[model samples]
Target: MPVHQVNKTIGEINERIRKGKAVVVNAEEMARIVNKEGKVKAAREVDVVTTGTFSPMCSSGLLFNIGQQPPVMKVSRMWMNNVPCHAGLAAVDCYLGATEPSEDDPLNKVHPGRFRYGGSHVIEDLLRGRAVHLRAQAYGSDCYPRRELDKDVTLADLPNAWLFNPRNCYQNYNAAVNLTSRTIYTYMGPLKPNSRNVNYATAGQLSPLFNDPYLQTIGLGTKIFMGGGIGYVLGSGTQHVAKPPRNERGIPTSPAGTLMLKGDLKQMKPRYVRAVSIVGYGCSLSMGVGIPIPVLNEEMAWFTGVSDADIQMPIKDYGYDYPNGLPRVLGHVTMEELKSGEIELNGKSTPTVPVTSYSMSLEIADELKKWIEDGKFLLTEKQEDIVSL
Candidate 1:
């Protein structure tokens, strides 16, 4: 029967029980519960038989059978169908946990093979992103040797710093040059379970909700129009990419999804802040495990109206101000004096430490107070152990 028809039939049977024209009866049946894998986890055998009879004088007679037992054959059939249903649900849950990819998944275009540069194979730019000078240049580094260039030499005229003597270079060099989608692997939990030899674009395809464009926009500088376009890092993973604000279409559709920046770089020191209010999931922002830092400027603070607090510290002595300074001092604080109330900090009663003082010592002192209260580090034991004992 169709679902609606089955429900209608059940409704009629229920109506018969309510009316005085029906005789009531009782019965019992068997049931079982099973895991998604179709393995039966529980089962119970039951006996069901209803006793009822219709009156001979009644033209429209009713037979009522109720209590515990429905048809065993029908119930068993539904129960078996539910087993596959449960199994499918569980498999989907496991797939979500085990197959989800992360933002750091690398991008490469070519698979590494037995190819040598300058001898048999020619080098090519296989990855996206404009090349920037290495933070530190080493003498005789694998980086391309600097060549004398004319005054008109552009970035294109520069040597390919990425190329190396492939034959003698370390294995790491080869991996860097020839990496491709097939060489990528994924991890499940702490274990590297499978070698995912799929296209690089397909890395994080498992998560329908995941969007890297929104992340790339985070901490990016706001563009202030001038006669010329503001400088931008052009290419993959750069902030110049157009990100859709939270709207009808786009990764983020709300203010929380929109990325914002905080702090003035012109100050004595730079600060950074996250303007977007993100919700972390198992690894997302709501749970707060992942660290999404401001790109470069370190001056930062998180502001929630009514109770404003500094979440970022000054780049210089940011450590000192952190736990006992102007900003809400967080982290380890070791106080020699015991105070009864919440530790209030400021110029008035804040304990100041010399810049040269060891931070670990302060941490130790703070821990000592807790130990003393717990009676673990007794004064008498300290005297006996340290002094001529």
Candidate 2:
């Protein structure tokens, strides 16, 4: 097997980036280069590859440090815009999950209600400089006297607003379809009866984890583009499977790795962090995330060279099998075939749609590349690698 004669270090790559001399390319471009010139040549020429994904991440949430009341009341319960928040932390600190539905939403009274607003909408409203009604209940105490508090506050009024997402950027995911006769709604959107339509989410070859497969350069303390601002990888996210089944290209065929990410909400753009509501499911936050992989060795170069055709996802039946906790997989399909607007399944050509925005992902990857080329972004050495088994 041929090997690249050059082996670069992250420090060397950062130095070159600082001097505006580093070679940076998006994952798509790197795949083409590897396809034509092979991994050996590609590794010798490229310094960095940028990857991106923009999708509805339900595990995302916001952390806020609302200022204490005048008498220092200890908040026992809190609600922002009628959406309940987890207030078991400090006196004034609270965490609001993106999927928390409003208490007054008609879903409580009606089946398959349209969940218009929820925690995600409140988050977006706050980020956009809008004030939300805040209500808190507290048990009166001698040290902390004030009990009831009601007011409207904007993001600026809070001491700290942070986006702490437990999971985002799923490495690979399921292509959902309905196997029953009736329609059903899920986080993947609505599925038509009898597998009439398929919905999948991922940026394919441009996804950060897909490009890094084994978590080589992506890990703790690795800097990334989070919701249009700089952020850091906290650790392995929830439901992250270290070792899942793989295809010939060494890519996971099932839902695999995930990222735990955190960033300053004050620096995020409203465009990159928006609210989304499923017809019958609930609310979620759609976010844009980008990770840069430094080409430090032949293996790194080869991994970044993976393309849509090389990546595949398992097909899952959401109508009956998934809801019943069955692990049966209907089949597998490549990202290339999914992107072509159709796929052959069960002896029929089925229509498909991507729940995530591929165009936004491309824009993010391009923007990250520009940040590196302009000497504004620098790669960081990971303190520890994400778990890989």
Candidate 3:
């Protein structure tokens, strides 16, 4: 057959393969039949090849004119059954099963190691030549729009950059399990015995709150004022008030009793994106976090040792950091430690996005098509499906 026709047929086959609609056959056995002489037939009757000669029958058990045919078939590679060929497919499994390291594949660019544990190694193999998806939960930083507070203080359209200066900050990590609540409590920083602490009194004095029923008050200091100190002053005028208590997870508990990091908590706001610390290191041991999931089907459950009743959620670790942003921190309890209910200090979680293979495949397919159009590939046909195989 002409190379163009052969390639076109191959391309069509590839398309079916890409979509998981193509039949998989043993290349070696198929080659044997293709090389056989007159009256030759396949040792094992494989799937019939479609043929125009068959007219409405549309199929032929044997390849026609094989003795006079030229070799055109090529086997680039093979994949193990039940394995994933791409990260996005793995992510689909991950998203469904709440798997980790699923989003960290190089194709995805979002390191699951920076977030959680476990991997879909076998699935990653099955998705080869397919698509990939990056599981990025957050895309942009949380924007804190400054609202107008007073006539003199005009709210700027620009954002307020709050740089966390670690050197001046206190830091620590603590873990406890509430027997009564049957929940874990992990604490880091300001509340710790020795943590990079944020001195609320000092920060408040710098920007004292203006007395109003709708606003909290703070204190300020001037060059000529008392001790030149700035902070929040008590109603008594002399004493200072500490910041509100952080929740058990070291998160700021909003008035509504929910742990809030950024955004309007009073409105029961949802922070689609925010900057959170993922993990920290004390120069001692390695740390990590893991999320669990229930297997979806009988086959999936059999291999994963989990049932569909399991939840699928990313296990995020609380974060920590040194005053200088040098030492790292992370929220993690080793499998052994967790089983024993023993815990340690971990770091904060950071903003991230959920990714998958389909998302990546689309990007790759687009680029491939562009490349072909740009003469990057020896493509003769304008129709992409013609190259299926």
Assess candidate 1 and give its TM-score to the true structure: 0.13
Top lDDT model:
2
Q: How accurate is candidate 2 locally (lDDT)?
A: 0.93
Each model's Cα RMSD = 35.3, 1.5, 31.6
Tens digit of per-residue lDDT, candidate 2, span 123-147: 9999999999999988878988988
Model 3, position 109: C-alpha lDDT score: 46
Residue 267 shift from truth in candidate 2, angstroms: 0.5
| Tens digits of per-residue lDDT for model 1, 1-389 | 21211111223322433442222111100001111211111111111111111000000100111111111111110011011111122111100110112222222113222111110000011111223121111122233232221122112433321111101100000000011222222110111112111111110111111222233222233211100111111112212123333322222211112111121111101011001111110111000001111111101100000010101111111222222434331222211111111222322233222211122222222333233233332211011110100
What candidate 2 gets wrong by more than 4 Å, as runs, is 1-4
Local distance difference test, each candidate = 0.16, 0.93, 0.19
Worst 10 residues of 2 by lDDT: 105-114
Candidate 3, after superposition: displacement of residue 303 in Å? 55
Q: Write the per-residue lDDT of candidate 3 for residues 227-302, one digit (tens) a residue.
A: 0111111111111123423333222211111000111111110111111222221001000100011111222111
* Better lDDT candidate (1, 3): 3
Q: Would you estimate the TM-scores of all the predictions? A: 0.13, 0.97, 0.14
What is the Cα-based TM-score of model 2?
0.97
lDDT value, residue 214 of candidate 1 = 35
